[model samples]
Target: MSKKVILITGASSGMGKETAKALIQEGHTVYTVARRIDHMQDLKNMGGYPIQMDVTNENDIQNVVDTIIKHESKIDVLWNNAGYGLYGAVEDIPVDEARKQFEVNLFGLATITQKVVPYMRQAKSGTIINTSSMGGKMYTPMGAWYHASKHAVEGFSDCLRLELQEFNIKVVVLEPGVIATEFGEVMLKNISQFSSKGAYSSLTNQLVTATKKMYDKGQGSKPTVISKTVSKIVNETKPKTRYRVGLWAKPMVWMRIYLGDKLFDKIIMSQLS
Candidate 1:
């Protein structure tokens, strides 16, 4: 709202890209970074700077942060949103795949945050919004590694929030539910590639069928929903520590919170395969 400098990762598509557009429209200076720099050309057209970055590469992360600082002096908000869904049974998913999943979703998120926090701390005023998922709060049957990474994000944010309170730096956890992104498609592909013909074929198929039904029926919310959440998180003077948006984010979290793990699992498994 105040023409602040904002940097968002995974801005090549989905909520990150949309949020960059929204923030620029509101007069903020936005630098959107992702591996697919070509996909962000449209963002550049909207007066947002698009930087090519692979969050997994420490050199890329350092260079990106240094470049942003050289130009902007300070970053007002950092959105660590670049991640993909890695869905499969833990037993079926290889150890290497599990490690890579954490590398992207959890470790990468932390790496970018580490680079930015020093700048934010120097300012003594900044917000770090980590894009976690409803999976962080709840669990699903074939999403062991994905869920594990998000849950780590939730806890990681909590600790960072507590530690940074003295510096006036805010760390907010963003939990998006079933949003209309290629995330589901990617998840399906991962399951099919990693576990489709394995011991969990029937279960993965059931999960796929349920997810397909949801996507086919246009049940997922637009990326704009989460874009609006991003705007609110930045604009609010006192944003919540956690904000859950998109379809089913609230109800599913409610089931987990009130119904207890056993009942929640029963309900979710019934809906899946």
Candidate 2:
């Protein structure tokens, strides 16, 4: 494979960081960005460039694209992987907080893509990989906003795939299952703060305990699984429009598809019990 210039967001930790390392190891010119540039020191040491960027900031997004274009002339791949799970009952999470979730997960991703797509169209060759989740396809308790954002990502990618085909720009969506990242911890904190003493406190407590057990037992796949999957996607001449990786990702999506809403709800609720 030719050495291609790649850009990845949310590279401060977890899947994004792992993907950056893998791509650099493959001899690609990688520029990784996240709010925490200090966290990417190791990536820089490994010959990958790191930029400090907040995905919600348009100026930051513009700066990142301009810098990459100025340096590499063309970006061969764009990985939109910056997002966080906001876990709390829809009734309890303030609308402002919910909007913030979309700002980072959906709108921010869309903005970055908009800035980069023109360049890719001019070059007539590029790949755009978006990070959705199993939750995008299936709903879970206390993740209303997060799931909605990811579901939006799925639809967004589908339409973009069709539109970009003429331009030779590929749009792929990644549906990651449970990966051992800061996700569990951050989610637990949010749910507790938002709903622990509210009308859904009982369900909130149950979910909190269950989530703790799942992650504490190391049941989630390692971040490297996603990294390897991304590497595969990046190198494929004709990659699938969607790739599902990590533990429980495939099975959960399947259950949601075949089991119907009532049965799927039963299974998910049974877990909380």
Per-model TM against the reference: 0.98, 0.99
Write one digit per residue (lDDT tens) for candidate 1, span 190-256: 9999878868999989999999999999999999999999999999889999999899999999999
Clash count per candidate: 0, 0
Q: Which candidate has the top score in TM-score? A: 2
Worst 10 residues of 2 by lDDT: 229-238
lDDT to native, each model: 0.93, 0.95
| Predicted structure 1: lDDT | 0.93
lDDT of 2 by residue, 1-273 (tens): 878899999999999998899999999999999999999999999999999999999999999999999998999999999999999999999999999999999999999999999999999999999999999999999999999999999999999999999999999999999999998998999999999996999999999999999999999999999999899889998899999999999999999999999999999999999
Candidate 1: the clashing residue pairs are none
